[model samples]
Target chain A: MKLSEILSLLEGTLVSEHADWDLEIGKVAAADLMSDVLAFADPESVLVTGLVNPQVVITADMADIVGIIFVRGKVPPPETVAVAREERIPLIITSYTMFEACGRLYQAGLKAVDLES
Target chain B: MSKVSQVTRLQELVYELEIAEVMTRDFLSVTPQMTMREFKEFLQEHRFSGAPVMEDGELVGIISIEDLIEALAAGELGCLVEAKMTRDPVVLKANDLVVRSVDYFGRFGYGRFPVVDDQGAIVGVLTKGDITRGLLRKLEVEYHQEEIRRARVNHIFDDVSSDHTSISLRYDVEARNFERGGRASRSIKRALKRFGLPRQIVRRAAIATYEAEMNVVIHADDPGGVITAEIQPDQIVIEAIDMGPGIPDIDLAMQRGFSTAPDWIREMGFGAGMGLKNIDRCADRMELLSPHGTRTTLRIVIYMDER
Candidate 1:
């Protein structure tokens, strides 16, 4: 799925630059725990989480997570925004809860990280 | 010295150094007949940590203070040096490159290794300190030589006039400075656009430049390095040179999702391991010169006339 489409569907505010909005994301992983995000997220996957911290962006970088969507309308701290800007990882803020965000992405055909793989 | 010259000097040191040039020739050795107690005293008296145990002019084993402590703890302090010494210990040949010893040191965590002759005789000992001292000395000599070469190159270039036919732009990239990361690529893009290059060509160059710049920021050690873009009538060449802990496995680093970036760096969203691949796809030709644990130079050439 293109990041722009996901952004519109969630009615999210893009905190990151628009340069990466056209990027194609193949999967989505939603989790509050950074460890779960690290273990389950793959490259090009858009990470959906309620956790608003610099570690979210860091986890995205380490796991090659393409974009991040902060659910529950959480406003990330300035440090987190700075890191996201620097890393060039796209960030989206959404009013949707974590469960709803995951469901929306999944229903839209974004696959979850398959443990079997 | 200017920063550019310093970088060039360090690069030459990595390329020009060899173990034979640096390995100590005069070194201490102990005989297998020496008792562990005597060996301990020998190490203490000389302030040495270890010595090769030579038997009949051949290196049979190596004993270190650690071995002595082990023997003491085991209540075997009276044991012969042969009994306590490590048999078939790792050794480095004189002709080996200094980089090989560096790899050995990193992998084995050994403080010292015996330097041996072709005849399997201990000629000297190679310690971590020896490598550091040797490299420093080599760096001084190479830095002077590099300055001379740079002066000659500059002299040649001084005659060339800056015209529509050719132009060069250089940008200094600071490692991990994400704030300034894409400035070089953006500037290059703007330059190419102003030069009236086709949109496709400009896009490719911009993408390649951005990836190369990010690679420098992401991977280069310490203060980071520079990228130079040379535009000719026929082609554009972008060279990114970094004082690096160079890519250990070029092939692996080139893979789609391979990245060594730590979690924190990743969280900021930069390391996708797609930098090199993207650079490759955007350039007509690309060359990487990476001497592991040293410097890395990446050259990307895009032919303007091809399209």
Candidate 2:
């Protein structure tokens, strides 16, 4: 699925200035814990989480996660947004809960990331 | 250290060296009460073309060689130095960057400027010669360091026909420093890419190193740990060693979802007990050594050919 399509389905607003709306995001890993995200996320996958700290951006950069979907109406602080902008990682914020956001994306043909893949 | 060309180094020095560092301290000053003849004698004795005029330890004016020449031409050698000196001369702060002085010199076309302290007292004088000399001295020191770094980098790339040719990289990880947690891993990844390694292999190595680094950042005691990567033609071996209150039960720590991390760490998205598992998944062979009071070392080996 294109990132734009996922954003609309999840009702998310891209907050970062540097973003690629047409990026292909076929895989996703949803976790509030960064360790889990780093462990299970496939490269180029979009991450869905409620954590709104700068570390989220750092973890996304390290895992090569292309974009982030912050759930539960959690907006990241300016420093976190700055990091996302510097890393050129798109940040999407949504009012939906983590479960709802993941479900919406999954229903929209995005596959869940697995360890074996 | 990264590679820096001479031009870039010079530019960096201009912004880095402060006016205080490049200015001439213990400078000679002429009191305003002295006559121009006395000032001429003082300048000739000290071999100075310019001097700052001070009264009660405060800068009042600047008298340069041109001012002196004008006084001589007008036959005003007996006039007081205050009568001939240029009053309320432009000055610079001691803490300002050398680049500011460069800008001032270009704009003012002055031979020198008096440097002042926070109290507006003259502390030193900065000249074009002083800036040039200071930059050259700093550049010399950095040039030697750069040469040593280039030598080390070249050693890594030399003699492929040798029986064993490998390069090792090491980085220190500080405990509880979540801000710099992944820096070591990122640098390792960059170095591997500089070697032109395969993308998949580099990704695996970077992921494995990053997991080990997170372990040290989230768990290790004060003074933290060390992450080292040794790369040969066939494989890469990464070692993460941490001085610690050692793990009491290695078996349980290795289990998935078994994390001793505090709530704060978990809230920050770490301490999921999946660090070791992630490293294990990325490596062809792995070893965990936690000797009772001393330290814990996680050794991970990944072959170059593996996908």
Q: Is the docking of candidate 1 incorrect, acceptable, medium or high quality?
A: incorrect
Query: Residue A48 of candidate 2: its Cα lDDT?
Result: 92
- lDDT tens readout by residue for model 1, B62-89: 8999999999999887899998889999
Best candidate per TM-score, number? 2
Per-residue alpha-carbon lDDT of candidate 2 for residues A1-117, written as tens digits (9 for 90 to 100): 888898889888999997788888889999887877877789999999999988888788778899999999898999889888877999999999988898888888889898774
lDDT of 2: 0.88
Best by DockQ: 2
Clashes of each: 6, 1
Tell me the lDDT of model 2 at A30.
94
- Per-prediction TM-score: 0.41, 0.60
